[model samples]
Target: MEFNFADRMSDLKGSAIREIFKVIAQPDIISFAGGVPSPDTYPVDALNEISQRLLVGNAAAYLNYGVTNGYPPLIEILKERLTKQGVVKDSDEMMITTGGQQGIDLAAKSILNKGDGLVCENPSFIGALNSFRTYEAELFGVTLQNDGLDVDEFKKTIKENKNIKIAYIIPTFQNPGGVTTSLEKRKKILEICKANGIIIIEDNPYGELRFKGEDVPTIKSLDTDGDTVIYVGSLSKVLSPGMRIGFVVANSKIIGKMEILKQVNDVHTNQFAQALAYEWLKNYDFEEHLEKARLLYKHKCELMLKTMDETFPEFVTYTRPEGGLFILCTINKEGIDSAEVVKACIDKKVAFVPGFTFMVDMTKTSNMFRLNYSTMSDEKIVEGIKILAGVLKTL
Candidate 1:
């Protein structure tokens, strides 16, 4: 007998990035498709020490059921850290999530309903987009300029659709595009959302991973009244993704509802992971750890950029990111499908994600693709670029 699924599951497709990742699992494949942090950067020894200490000394805290709002010490630490970063306020509250992805999912679930309008950058994070899609929200794509979301287009989009519930942004070193929204644009986005009463969901997993540029103030920081912003930060990039520890900063009222949602979702994020992360933070030099991760990613980004310059065709253009795991490449060839190129690259033992995965309209995004530089070694990056360059020539 066949089992029927929920109607919402009908329109929801599996993440294209994850699908490509499965295809590139062969040992020969050099994958530029995964948005994963380097395993070499993980603080394994520190985490091991932290885990052992927590279990030996604080077993009750580790093994028992935790508060739905999260492990309080972790939440408190996040509040302190994010307050310094300009996201959390003295008046604001925080909620710990299983990971950054859960923050997105909970935000969508708490705020959105079917056919509710949501504005996101034209090519946004696939996971966040998929999370919003699960709620059957009608998405409006705002064009992303070099500086940020196009203000003129955004104003028009808001004007045309007045019922927008959320405006989601990955302001710093955005996924796939690798474009940071400018400070001026950040303020303007906040103003637009404020005027329209639209909630701004700022996903900032990569903000602390900056290796080459000045830190920009988060849009959430600019919210003096806590009227319009919900900020999500992650330890996935900076500390350890496997720990699955992340936090959300929002008004206490919103966070109250989210805490209930969190309870139902995973009965609170992993207590052992939270305790371990807290122990790691307490025992290690986190700033130094972050700096090391930054340096590693910076070198990888530089290597990929240099390889692209030497090997890719003149018509292929890509972003030069200040930080983060990804760079967007636009192929100049008309009618050349990136999905087909990705399949060809897989055959050649190199893998990258097609751009359509990030776009609301997949049919119109054939000329683009996203490359991630954070998960591979310098040699793997070079080899992957060479293999992809060969594939592009054939295309």
Candidate 2:
């Protein structure tokens, strides 16, 4: 018998980052593929303490069915924290998600139907790009500059593209680009999106890991009324991704729609995990933990950048991100294929993601690739780059 599938499934493929893991799963291969928070920063002792008490004392709360939005205590704590940071408004509502990824998925679900126009940075996060594609949205890519999304290109794209239902951005410490959007640009982007009636999905998973720069006010915070922007935040970077704790801050209308979608998505995020995040944030010195993470990442990122500068060929240019886990590399010369470079490096037991997978249009090849610094050790980072450099010299 033949099987039927949805139209969206025809051309869609699994994430390149995840698929790369399957190919390079051997222990000897030094991988710079995942954007996971370092395990060294996990508050194991605190979580162990919280988990022990919660299981013995409050098993029902976690095990039993709960509201689709989230655990109430965790929600309240998040509301308070974000409000203090100027991200949450009195008129806005919030919902907890499985992770920041689901928040992006729900945003796509809330605003997009098939073939609706969607605007995002040229090389945005692969997860978000794929999520939007699942709805068969017509994606418009805005070129990225060192500061963030190019404002002129953004304005041009939005003006040229009609039927754009949603605009997505990662203003602070962006994923693959590893660049922060300037406040001037953020204001401009926000104003333009609001004027155009495009809902903004601000995916900020790495906002808390600012190891080298001053805080840039989030676009959601600038949206004082909280209607135009959907702020998607996660504890995956500073805390544990395994906890699957993420939240969305937006107006009641958007929140109401997402709440229903969440009900259908997974009913809600894990209850015990939510409780653990709540306890960690409210009781423990989370700021202290975050400080340690920042310092750790700072050292690793600097070491990686320095290694790249010294070992990599002069034709290779890359971003020096103040924060975030990635450093995006571009080969300056022409006719040198990105895939070939990746294959060569992989052959040498070193791996990083090729840049095309992160683009809105994946049909074209890219000369860029992304290197991650947070997951590997100092020795591995240096060793990986030396191996990569040797491969590039042959090109």
Candidate 3:
């Protein structure tokens, strides 16, 4: 029998990160391929205790169906947290989704029509790019500088391209590149978007992981009109990915539409998980736990960078992220494809994702690649860096 799939399936490819995970699952392999939290930092004990309490005392509420918008207590708590940061004022402005990825998908679905334009960083998050692609969005890539998105180029792109619906950004501690946008740039980008009537989709899954610098205000926080920015956040980086709890903060009108759309998607997010997340937030000392995680990531990042400095060729350069799970390595040697480097590293039982996979056009080659340091130990990081340096040297 022949099967017909939707046209959207034609260009959608499997996640490069997940594909790499298969090869690196071997115990002997030292993988810097996944942007995952360290197992050592998971609050297993706290969650276990929370789970028992929920089962014993709150099983009726937790095990039953939840509202499409999410668990109410969780919503109130999250709203208060974001309010303190000046992102959103009212609880109705938010909707809890399964994770940040779903929030991205919902935001794109709500605003984008087929062939609408979406301006994004050149090397943006693959998941977000793919989500927009599902809606047949025409992606316009703007250069991403060390400080953040290039405001001048962004303005030029918007002026040249018609019908650009939104500007999708991961302003703070961006994935793959791990670069944070400066406060001045953030304001400028917001101004540009507002001037052009383009919505700003702010995906910030890693902001809470900052270990070095002071926290920059979110683009949503900067929205004086309150309707221009849709902020997406997750507990994946701070809490547990398996629990799958994330939320979207937007204007009430936008959030109401998303809530309706969500009803047709999954009916609602998991009830048990939402209950557990709410309980965890209410009871646990999350700040202390966050500090510990930040220190751990900081130490690992330092170790990785120090090793690369000593081992990698002088021609090679990498980003110095204040905080995030990744570092983008640009090998200056001409004709060196990062894909080849990844393949060779796998043979040596070490892994890092090639940069091209994150690009809007995967066929385009780059001498760049991304490495993650959060999941590996000090010794494993040293070993992986040594192996990767040898691979780069040979190329």
Question: Measured by TM-score, how close is model 2 to the native structure?
Answer: 0.98
| Model 1 misplacement above 4 A | 363-365
lDDT of 2 by residue, 305-383 (tens): 9998899898999999988888999998888668788988888899899988999989888999999999898999999
Q: In model 3, which regions exceed 4 Å deviation?
A: 90-92
Largest lDDT belongs to which candidate?
3
lDDT of each: 0.87, 0.90, 0.91
lDDT digits (tens) for residues 1-395 of candidate 3 = 88898987788998898899899889999999988799998889988999998899968988889899999999999988989989885533889998999999998999999999999998999999999989999999888889898989999999999889899999988888899999999999999999889999999999989999889999988887647899999999888888889999998888998988899999899999998889889999888989999999999999999999999989999999999799998999878889988998899999889988888787788888999999998999999999899888887
Give the per-residue Cα lDDT of candidate 3 at 104: 93
lDDT of candidate 3 at residue 167, scale 0 to 100 = 98
Ranked by lDDT, top first: 3, 2, 1
The RMSD of every model to the true structure, in order and in angstroms, is 1.2, 1.1, 1.1
Give the TM-score (vs. native) of candidate 1: 0.97
Clash count, predicted structure 2: 0
Q: Which of candidates 1 and 3 reaches a greater lDDT?
A: 3
Which residue runs of candidate 2 sit more than 4 Å off their true CA positions?
Answer: none
